[model samples]
Target: MVELVVQKYGGTSLQTTGRMAEAADRIIKETKRGSQVIVVVSAMGRTTDDLTTLAGQVSSCPPAREMDLLLSTGEQVSCALMAMALKAGGVEAEALTGPQAGIITDFSYGDAVIKEVDPEPVRSRLKEGKVVIVSGFQGCPGGHEVATLGRGGSDTTAAVLAGALKADRCEIFTDVDGVYTADPGTITGARKYEQLDYESLSALAELGASVVHPRAAAAAEAWQIPLVVRSSLTEQTGTTILPGTWSSCSFPVIGVTSETGLSSFSLHEGADRREIGREWKNGLCPWKAVQHVKNRLYRIVVRNEEAPHTKSLLSRFGGRPDTGRALVHVIFRSKEGKQKAGSFMRDLPYTQDCFMVETQPHVWSMDVPERHRVNICQALHDRCMEKEAAPISAAH
Candidate 1:
């Protein structure tokens, strides 16, 4: 039996014809190594963003269904172009949209959840000795409806396909080599993790690490699929996410992640909590937080892109919005991690306006001003690394 491999290439890896050709070469090499390859491609660099911008120019608020219909086209372009590149490399390859590949989802338009996937469509192609390239991020419920999974949806598509096909492994090729202790762009001394458990990666991804999507990490965990994160431009080894919790140290803190462009809201007295819940669910909005603080007051954090829709939902219930906020999370390996992080945050004199919350026993979340996001991440990351290195220094 031939081993099956599921590979996902992000926008940066397929930004140009040269890059697309590189991806095609990578896929062809795998076929030569005696493996059946299934390729998942994202829209080329900035295509999705460009499409969104174009929609905004036409309408202040585009209809969700139409937006999905428009966004789904980006992935189709990528899939077709990738197939052409592979063919030019003298390999038999075919392109299929998400629906054509048998990905079924609900009618949520913008952020649809995959209901089921039938791998037979892809398997048939594999049996024909053709490399299959599937458009990621868009699936259909039924006739004439196209729904896009939210940002980073390609990662989820690859993981789900790997599980459905029982592939040997799922490799996610991105611009970065692997998952790091912090965003390397922000923290210059950040360390790259060689291996991470599902729980750790899931926590990091959910908290705002762009390395992997939270749903993808969860699906891989559920299916017990081996997931690897590698660099598309280099041959260096990347991070492997596997089952079981493994730690490199007892310090507990493992990574730091930060997200900007946030709009926060506070639901005060007389707000209809139930109605707000329905709107959130039905609207498919990404709420970063919905925590109850005190005295019937609830704090909600959402991305800036979805703020307009979220604000409209909030206003119906006496809620107020505050933009230019940022969220940073410190992920840890143990419960004790929270206490340590909390103590450190309390003592740090960075910003008095910052508020800390114990989102999870192993996750410390901070709501800070956008201006201080990078500084806070850098400080916390450096402190964690200091603790990590202390033990070795003492032994020496």
Candidate 2:
């Protein structure tokens, strides 16, 4: 038989008992396909949120250890429910928490990374020909320190399992059909990629695609593990993510995706502010998109002249006046910055369908989707290269 396949089902995929049953069937099917199966799952949909709210009810501000202990229950409940469902289906399955599963990590509550995973117990269960269902997001590694993968860490959990088991592929099942150009919820014509390499998908995920978590991609790529973003809704082919390219295609526009909760800022106090701008890099929005076919967008840094004026601008935009402990040191997503979005998008494919694409002047805004940016940008770049080639060719 082939090596075990590490499969991960997200919160949405395991929202209900019926959904869990469906997922269990899928896991069983994979197990019967000569693939030893180890499954990882997150808490059911909204369960974590509900738990947090419940804890907040008891204490307006709960301590981190208590928070970790409270938050960890959602995944445990899910793991147990899934195991029960699997057993009901006449499949012998065992559910294990991150602690019981031997997922050891540094002592950090609420947000922790996996330091190591001892798959001995998992291997033993598989040896007895039983399927193993492991909790995905929360792990208890050390004393009183329950570590939870920060948002979307379940994907990281699955990748870690795949690496530990030496699995050939890690299948992540979600609600969507597959990874698309833009979020299907926003753009109807968003194209679906048949496949992508780990690098490109990882870049996409880093930029803003929540389809896969960056930490998970990093782990999988480091281990040279293959991951596929499949669907729980159907048995059809999902997008395949390899370490390299898939077959060729002529789709000029690869895809479209957007980042909500996005805030833009401008820094303009000094000239050549690269050094100051560099410090703001951590809060930089990393996602990119292909708007359509003709242009590209890039992120740049904006700096300001005076700290006082910058602080005023930030305060005007609902930011606290305290600059020392702010997430955004510079004022981004200010009213002026928001107003300039239309003009900025005009030059990129991202604004291809803008109200006045041709009318607006191009301003060097930091927010540009990498793919399908303004088509006119490509036209300009192409024209510049052509002019350079023409002059050189004529001289030759």
Candidate 3:
């Protein structure tokens, strides 16, 4: 069987002129191994922010639809640079926009979900022995309007490609060697995982592991696609999100990931509480849910980066933060211990009595306790179990 691989290069991996060339060279080297290649590239650096700034200047409150149009340029610039890099490496490569690549999505503007991918052109180019470079994270649905898949979206594009093309593996090239136990910059003794299950990977994504998108991981997990997170700066192997990598490892949380600029909502009002609790929601839209309370007092979590806007958003509706952090660990717990350990979750909407989200043996979870001066993590250390781990291989 012929081998075809789908690889995604994040913004940091394509930050500088040298990095762009370096990334292209990596893709070209893979192609030279007699395998077909499909490459996904993000905007070189803060191009998305630059575009956002321009969009805001044009419209005080930029519409989501138009913002998609502005942000699509990020991926285009990346694709062009990647194509140029491939050409410099003696590879016959062509960069195609999301539409040109046939990535069909729903009508969502800023965060569209991929619906279908016609891989005919992609496969044709590969059959003709050419490398195909695609602009990730943006696609069109039912018309000519450009749509974006939101931040950290390019990773989803690559995983979707792997599922559609049935590639050998979806290799994600980023700055880190692989998924680590923590940010490494923050926590001590943060180890990297050789392999992670899809469920665990999703947990990490929610916890701020930038290596993969939860939506993309969902797609790959649904199709059993092998997804690898490796460093573009080094030859070392990264973490692989696989099916049964943790049949033995009993770690309840595979990694300690954090997110900053978070705002937690604390609702307190009898009138508001009596109206079926129409407020508190968390995470992305799909992950959103309604919160029910006997009283109006409620809490919601939001990114600190958006706090200024969030405060304004809530001020309009009588919202206030009980307290928040510039950054948070966003911890994880296993289903096995959900009821025993996180009984507080029963009071919220997303959380139910013993009703937990999907999880793996190696998974991550988080929650906020009633008491602010609490650390739920002291028990996480007890989650580590003795298993037959292979001798730790030096990253290479």
CA lDDT, candidate 1, residue 97:
97
Count: clashes, candidate 2: 31
- Model 2: per-residue Cα lDDT at residue 213: 89
Model 3 TM-score, 2 decimals: 0.78
Clashes of 3: 16
Error of 3 at 209 (Å): 1.9
- lDDT (Cα, tens digit) per residue for candidate 1, span 36-141: 9999999999999999999999999999999999999999999999999899889999999999999999988899999999889999999999999999998888
Sort the predicted structures by lDDT, highest score first.
Answer: 1, 3, 2
Choose 2 or 3, whichever is better by lDDT.
Answer: 3
Worst 10 residues of 2 by lDDT: 323-332
TM-score of each: 0.87, 0.72, 0.78
Models, CA RMSD each:
4.2, 10.6, 6.2
lDDT of each: 0.85, 0.62, 0.68
lDDT of 3 by residue, 248-367 (tens): 445444544555444455444543543323333332222111233444434445555555655665574576753444222323345643433334333333322112222223333343
Weakest 10 consecutive residues, lDDT, candidate 1? Answer: 387-396
lDDT of 2 by residue, 247-350 (tens): 23222123222333322233233323343234334444231111111232112212222344434534433432212111110011224433433333345443
